[model samples]
Target: QFDRKSQEYRALKRYWKLIQQDSRKLSDKRFYRPMFRMHLTNKEILEKLLSYSDELRQHYELYQFLLFHFQEKNSDHFFSLIEQEIATVNPIFQTVFKTFLKDKDKVLNAMELPYSNAKLEATNNLIKV
Candidate 1:
């Protein structure tokens, strides 16, 4: 069992490296193909039991929105998207969505803050080091 897990971990790591390489390509399609392949691979691993790819795609969309479209006005839309995706038939995704929902207030508060605390966190980490 341990060996099987280790093998799976290594395979995923190599696949991620391939995806990262494609991410550096000039064409959007180049990056997309590997991501799509990875999604398919994930689905195969689960024996096509559920639409895990859709869940992953939705998560990616949410991530992109958070990274690029995070604004006070978009907060409601963000939460709505999360809720919509959470309603899907996937226990794993549902659990993850519930955790995010529980922390919605904190996430929204941080998004509304004018300044980021990333620099502060980095300085604190440096001090600890």
Candidate 2:
């Protein structure tokens, strides 16, 4: 049986290869390195992730710069830019999104009905119309 540890190691190995070939313009290069380093317990891996996140996000060829940075000068402005990018990209996922825009405890408490009463209200409005 393949253990969970083995699986994580395999994922890490795949992650390293993904980073090393980041300049090759492979389809996986854009987001693979940060995703891979996200789970590691070591500082080196974390540094790699941080560096790659900055470098790739600044790169002109990839979509990362287009999303989070662009013409924005500050991190807050950049994050606001990213929020708009996410909203446009995933219109159907507003509630999963509110989870971030709102307080976590509140977001989790409201999770039970992101679509419940709202749908009924819309249905009632349609029926009246």
lDDT of 1: 0.54
Q: Kindly report which residue stretches of model 1 are placed more than 4 angstroms away from their true locations once superposed.
A: 1-12, 15-73
Worst 10 residues of 2 by lDDT: 59-68
Pull out the clashing pairs in model 1.
none
The residue-by-residue lDDT of candidate 1 on 1-129, one tens digit each, is 125446445454445333222222323232222523453443243222223245544554455564454553478777787787677636876787798789988878777767788999999999999
lDDT (tens digit, per residue) of candidate 2 on 17-101: 4343333234522332353544343333433533544533233223334332422333454445447655544444456446456
TM-score, every prediction = 0.51, 0.22
Off by over 4 Å in 2: 1-13, 16-75, 90-97, 104-129
| All candidates: CA RMSD (Å) | 7.6, 15.7
Best candidate (score: TM-score):
1
lDDT of 2: 0.45
- Model 2 residue 42 CA deviation in Å: 17
